[model samples]
Target: MDLTVIWAAIIALGLFMYIALDGFDLGIGIIFPFFPDDSERDLMMHSVAPVWDGNETWLVLGGAALYGAFPAVYSIVLSSLYLPISFMLVCLIFRGVSFEVRGKANRTKNLWNLSFILGSAGATFFQGVVLGAYLQGIPVKNGVFFGDAFFWVTPFSFFTGMGLLITYSLLGASFLVIKTEGDLQRRMHGLIWPLTLVLIGFILVVTLWTPMTDPHAASRWFDSPARFLLYPVPILVIVVATFMFNAMRHQHDSMAFLLTIILVFLGYIGLLFSIWPYAIPGAITLWDAAAPRSSQVFLLVGAVVIIPIIIAYTTAGYWIFRGKAEASTHY
Candidate 1:
């Protein structure tokens, strides 16, 4: 019944939607260079073109919701993450422009190709850096940011950035397996096992590093007797990842894709469990970071109406375009 709880849920939902949805498209962009043929790359682009814009809407919604409903969180996080967030926005712009201009100018096609690839990687890396910075705990004094601008630039953050790139690449490869066929899908198949292995390594590193680096987060997982409530999460993640690996071997593209997504969702849920009740990890709880009650109620009313419509529209778009993408396919 608390407005802070309601808004926190809304913000979390929006961010999760953005990560899961836009993540694949960014992954596709990261893997664009693997295909030597421009035509194959076009097939990859076309596969995501129909839904990428809509997928990005969740990002906008998440940012807006945070700024509107939790101004304190917005101000502090934005102040701390200004440079990385700015860089991410610039990369996204280049990527979006590349998508639009690549077909129009054949001479500069290579330029656009590079733009898309770097843009995707840059955006994803910075996002991971932001995540790492938050996970490491942002410094706050009297409800304001007190950290240096370069607080996000560290070895662990860089490792997290690379981990995200690999993860996105894996997601992209899985998507290609689902949406492509013949030679392209075969190439994706070749990439899958290696990507999966690297991703497992990254996960292992994070799993080990997180608790060592942040004792508070460690306590959440280790000290709580009630944590048995989440006992099945790691088990489910392992099961899904195993199924996906097997599905990949069997060339069951759709099943592999679905399983991979489930794995990502389970990880997301695990993270939510670790960071619950806190909007800014150790620094600020959701209620402390929340806006006025009246503002939250007003926003909640609009969100209740708008969110379902967004979901329905996104579902319809995906349903209408459901099928494998071909070289000729373009949105």
Candidate 2:
């Protein structure tokens, strides 16, 4: 068996899980300003409070897996992107603290609310910057990151940062549609179509921009035989977007959220296809960056035992907390 491929799959699964689970909660913070009423904010926080912290487990799993399974890529990427990565971590710290303190504070609730918004937006923006920087290809030579710290601060990276903000806001809104009712649900439902339109616009920009600027990506999309397989992704995205629009129009709450998830998945697939086989895009293949075979075997054993347990508990948490959030509930 190719342990490198297996490990790569595991890391991909872990990252996608993180995006799917944690994206909405961080998104709640991004859209917090839209619903300025304190009570409505309470309900929004309550909807995600139970599972929000747990949603980050996949992030931990993904980072650890990368360190163990592909140490070279981990070290090089982290070192090169340290500034944005550090900023993202700091923002998450503020966001997590606000999540806990806002529920209890009587007078300082507004302060915490501000903290939450800044934290979420900062973390998400930097995440998109990091992603864009990675996609544009890290500067590497002889297995080391050779670029200066500000290499990630380009226009494309900032555009990606803004794009992620919209994406997560949409996720947050659709999730609220699932977890609230009455005026809050109505407002969220109202926001869905506009957010979807905005998201589609960002998607179109990225689709065109990536190929226009990156020769490798352009070749992958236009020249490779794999293009045949890749062609269905955008079509599926359109189909999913259409379904999501209809679901929102008809007020199919659960279906809207599910379709939104599908929309995100299709986008994720496109990204993976764009960077297939390359851990550092043009620089390094997964096999070239993979850790020793013995190390992977050991890590695989632990991952096998741990991943299922995490899945079981995460599933239980969601199931137990299912249904519309109550204003009286505090979490």
Q: What are the per-residue Cα lDDT tens digits for candidate 1 across 1-331?
A: 7888878888889988888889899999998887869889889998888888899999999999999999999999999999999999999999999888887778889999999999999999999998888888899999999989998998888898898898888888888888898999998988887787787778768878887887777888888775787778878867877886788788887776677678777767767777776889888998888899999989889999999999999999899888899777656
lDDT of each: 0.86, 0.92
Judging by TM-score against the true structure, name the best candidate: 2
Q: Which regions of candidate 1 deviate over 4 angstroms?
A: none
Worst 10 residues of 2 by lDDT: 255-264
TM-score of 1: 0.97
TM-score per candidate: 0.97, 0.99
Over the stretch 41-155, how does candidate 2's per-residue lDDT look in tens digits? 9999999999999999999999999999999999999999999999999999999999899999989989999999999999999999999999999999999999988999999
Q: For model 1, which pairs clash?
A: none
